[model samples]
Target chain A: AQTVTQSQPEMSVQEAETVTLSCTYDTSESNYYLFWYKQPPSRQMILVIRQEAYKQQNATENRFSVNFQKAAKSFSLKISDSQLGDTAMYFCALGGGSNYKLTFGKGTLLTVNP
Target chain B: DAGVTQSPTHLIKTRGQHVTLRCSPISGHKSVSWYQQVLGQGPQFIFQYYEKEERGRGNFPDRFSARQFPNYSSELNVNALLLGDSALYLCASSPRASSYNEQFFGPGTRLTVL
Candidate 1:
């Protein structure tokens, strides 16, 4: 069984600042996918970014990027120019090669203050 | 294209009552997955179905069951629900059941068990 862990319970960032949320996973599979999802107060789970285990290049969206270290089994999300709308609970997830089911970590509540 | 959509945005149920949640996958998507998100925690995988066949299941018990229809829509049914079952039920869909494809999520159905 794969397990994702987000050590940070809560994180806060000022508007326009940068913040990083840490994540780590335990998996025996050599091929998998890592993802970061954001759930706002509206309860909508939005895909933020994704990283393929085979790819060394990290995934980056408009204001979201990831620091993926396959060797350490770590995948962290970085929010740049954070906005008030960015306030939400961030989750790290792992999906093994053959299974699309995702194992998620305890979320980190991120508050972006304007 | 339409994104994954779930029905009954919010529901309130009593303990021991059964509850049903619905989800419609995006057009052309053949895989549907269900997850449970308790308060202050990440979403936990429940079941995954592809082409109307059960592909994977998580650590959940038999009380949780789900099925995917021929049209690719899905329903999650919980029997003899407990207080711990009160949480957001999320549905996700992807083109196929593979780690290479990113799963698209729906606005979850919030289930409140009293």
Candidate 2:
């Protein structure tokens, strides 16, 4: 079974600054995918970024990027130039080639202070 | 294009009662997945359907059942609901069964069991 863990329960960052949310997963499959999802006050889950395990290059989506360490089984999300709009509950997820089911971390409540 | 959509934004049910949640996948999407997000916890996979067929299921009890319609829409039925069943039910959709595809999510239906 695959499990994702987000050690930080909560995080805060000043506006215009940067923050990195850590995530790690336990999976025996060498071929998998990692994802970061954000849920705002509206309670809508939105995909932030995704990384393919086979791709050695990290995934970047504007200000959002992932530092995927396949050997370490770590996939952390970094939000640069954070804004108030970025404040939300962030969840880390893992999925392997054989399954479409996503295993998610506990989530980290992020707050961006102006 | 509109993303995934869920009906009955909120629902209240008594213990031992039954409830049903509905999800409409994004246009042209062939896969729909269900997840349960407890308070202060990440979403857990419940089921996945593709092309009106069950592709996967989570560790949930038999009381939890779901089906996909011909239109690719889905319904989740939970019989003999318990307090533990109270959570936000999220519906996600992807273009296909590939694990690398990013899923689009709905706002979620908040289920409260009293």
Candidate 3:
């Protein structure tokens, strides 16, 4: 079974600064996918970024990027130019090639300060 | 375009009762997945349906079940609910159940078992 872990329970960042959310996973599968999801007070889950295990290059989507270290089994999300809108509960998820289901971490509450 | 949508924005039930949650996938999506998000935790996969067939299931007990319709819409049914069952139920859809496809999520149905 694959499991994801987010050590930080809470985080805060000043507006326009950068923040990194840490994530780690345990999986035996060689082919898998890592994802970062955001949930605001509205309770909607939004995809922040995704990274494939096979890709050596990290995934970047505008201000959101991922630092994927396959050997270390770590996939961290980096949010640049943090804004008030970036405040949310961030979760790290894992999906394997054999199964389509996702395994998620407990989540980290991020508060962006103005 | 409309994102994934779930019915009954909020629900309340009691122990030994039953509950049904509905989900409408995005247009052109062929796969729908169900997840349960307990308070202060990440979402846990419950079931995944593709093309109206059961593609995958999580570690949940038999008390939970689901099915997909011809239009790719889906329903999650839970019987003999317990107070622990109170959580937010999320629906996600993808164009197909593939390693490269990223799932889109809905706002989710908040279920409260009192």
Candidate 4:
């Protein structure tokens, strides 16, 4: 069994600022995958970033990055130059081995104030 | 090409009723997955089908079932619906060529049970 946890229930940031959402996970698989997905008011879940457990290098998108600590089982997402469009519910997920199922956290509500 | 698409944008049902949700994956995508999002929670994986066969399943009850067609389209059926079943059902698809590519998501079907 695998589980993902997001400590922050809600977070607010100003436009152009930077914010980081925290995530931690537990999995029996020695090798696994970490992902951050964002769901906005449009009701669609979009991939923000993903980190492979084997890769020490953190995964990053244009404005989204992740600090993945494999030893600590921490996978946090950082958003720089945040925009209004960044306001959404962010989820941390775990996927591993031959099991294609994704175990997700409860999610953190992020609000970017203009 | 258009992204993943889901049918019956919204639905209302009563306890003991049955509901069916549909999804069409992106062109050339053969791996389809289903998830259920309950209000403020993150989406929970339900099923995954690839090449017209069941590849993975989550912790969901047997009441929740799904299948993929030859065209890569899929349907999720829930029987004995309860108030707890009210949620947003999301479908995601990914090309099988990419080992760990992010799944493209649909707008999701919002199901409300009374």
Candidate 5:
């Protein structure tokens, strides 16, 4: 079974600053996919970014990027130029080509202060 | 194109009761997955269906079941609900069963089991 861990329960960053949310997972599969999801107060789940384990190059989407270290089983999300709208519950998830289900971390609540 | 859509944005039920939640995946998407997100926690995979067939299921008991139709719409059913079952039920869909594909999510149905 794959388990994702988000060590930080909560994180705070000032507007226009940068913040990183750490994530680690336990999986035996070498080829897999990782993702970051944001859930706002409205309870809508939004996709932030995604990374393929086979690709060494990290995934970047606008202000969001991931530092994916396959050997360390660590996939961290970095939010640059943080805005108030970025404040939400962020989750890290794992899935592979053979599996359709996604295993998610406990989540980190990020607060972007103005 | 419309994103995933879920019905009964909010629902309340008592223990030992049954509840059904519906989900309509984004147009052209052929896979639908269900997840449960408890308060202050990450979403947990419940079930996944592709091509109208059961693809994967989580550790949840038989109390949780789901089905997908030809149109790609899905439904989650919970029987003998318990208080611990209270959570936000999310529906996500991808173009196919490919793990590398990104999933789009719906706003979710907040189920309160009292």
Candidate 6:
């Protein structure tokens, strides 16, 4: 069974600043994938980033990036130059292999204040 | 191309009642996945279908079932609903069944059980 854990329940950051949301996961499968998804009040789940367990390099998308430490079973998302629009509930998920199901963490509510 | 779309943005049901949510995947995408997200928590995988075949099933009970159509659109049905079943049902679509494929999500359908 795969389990994901996000220790932080809530966090805050100022606009134009940076914030990192922590995530840790334990999985039996050697080949797995990690993901960060953001859900806004609109109730839409948006993909923020994804990282493959086999890859040593972190994944990045525009202002969003991940600090993926496979050895530590950690995958944290960093949003640089945070904007008000970035405020949302962020989730960490683990999947891959033949499991076909993604396990997600409880999530962290991130607020970007002006 | 249009993203994944779901019908009936919201619904209200009672115990013993049945409900069905619909979803249309992105053009050319053949995989559809369902999730249940309770308030203040992350989404839980329910099922995954690829090319109109059941690819995976989660820990959810038999009351929760889903199927994909020839066009790759899908429907999630929950029978004998319970208050614990009240949640946001999310639909995600990807081009392939592999986890390597990026899954695009839709605005979820909020189910309220009274």
TM-score of each: 0.95, 0.98, 0.98, 0.96, 0.97, 0.97
Q: Taking the tens digit of each residue's C-alpha lDDT, what string does model 3 give over B1-114? A: 999999999999999999999999999999999999999999999999999999899999999999999988999999999999999999999999753578899999999999
Instruction: Report the lDDT tens digits of candidate 4 across residue range A44-97.
Output: 889899999999999889999999988899999999999999999999988877
Chain B global fold similarity (TM-score) for predicted model 1 against the true chain B: 0.97
lDDT of each: 0.90, 0.93, 0.93, 0.91, 0.92, 0.92
Per-residue CA lDDT of model 2 for A1-114, tens digit only, reads 899999999999999999999999998887888999999987688899999899999999999999998888899999999999999999999987687799999999999999
Across B41-69, the per-residue lDDT of candidate 5 in tens digits comes to 88899999999999988889999999999
* Runs of candidate 6 exceeding 4 Å displacement: none
Which wins on lDDT, candidate 1 or candidate 3?
A: 3
Stretches of model 2 off by over 4 angstroms after superposition: none
Q: DockQ scores for all the models shown? A: 0.72, 0.81, 0.74, 0.63, 0.79, 0.78
What are the per-residue Cα lDDT tens digits for candidate 2 across B52-102? 888998999999999999999999999999999999999999989655788
TM-score of 1: 0.95
Answer with 3 or 6, whichever has the higher DockQ. Answer: 6
Model 3, A1-114: lDDT tens digits are: 899999999999999999999999999898998999999987688889999899999999999999999999999999999999999999999987788899999999999999
RMSD of each: 1.3, 0.9, 0.9, 1.4, 1.0, 1.0
Q: After superposition, how far is residue A81 of candidate 1 from its true place, in Å?
A: 1.5
Stretches of candidate 5 above 4 Å error? Answer: none
- Candidate 5 lDDT over residue span A1-114, tens digit each: 788999999999999999999999998887889999998888678889999899999999999999998889899999999999999999999988577888899999999999
Residue-level lDDT tens digits of model 4 in B1-114:
999999999999999999999999999999999999998888898999999999998889999999999999999999999999999999999997222678899999999999
For residue B91, model 1's alpha carbon misses the true position, in angstroms, by 0.6
TM-score of chain A of 6: 0.97
Chain A TM-score for predicted structure 2: 0.97
Give lDDT: candidate 6, residue A47. Answer: 86
Better of 1 and 6 by DockQ: 6
- What is the i-RMS of every prediction? 1.4, 1.1, 1.4, 2.4, 1.2, 1.2
Interface RMSD of 4: 2.4
Instruction: Give the range of the ten consecutive residues with the poorest summed lDDT in model 6 chain A.
Output: A39-48
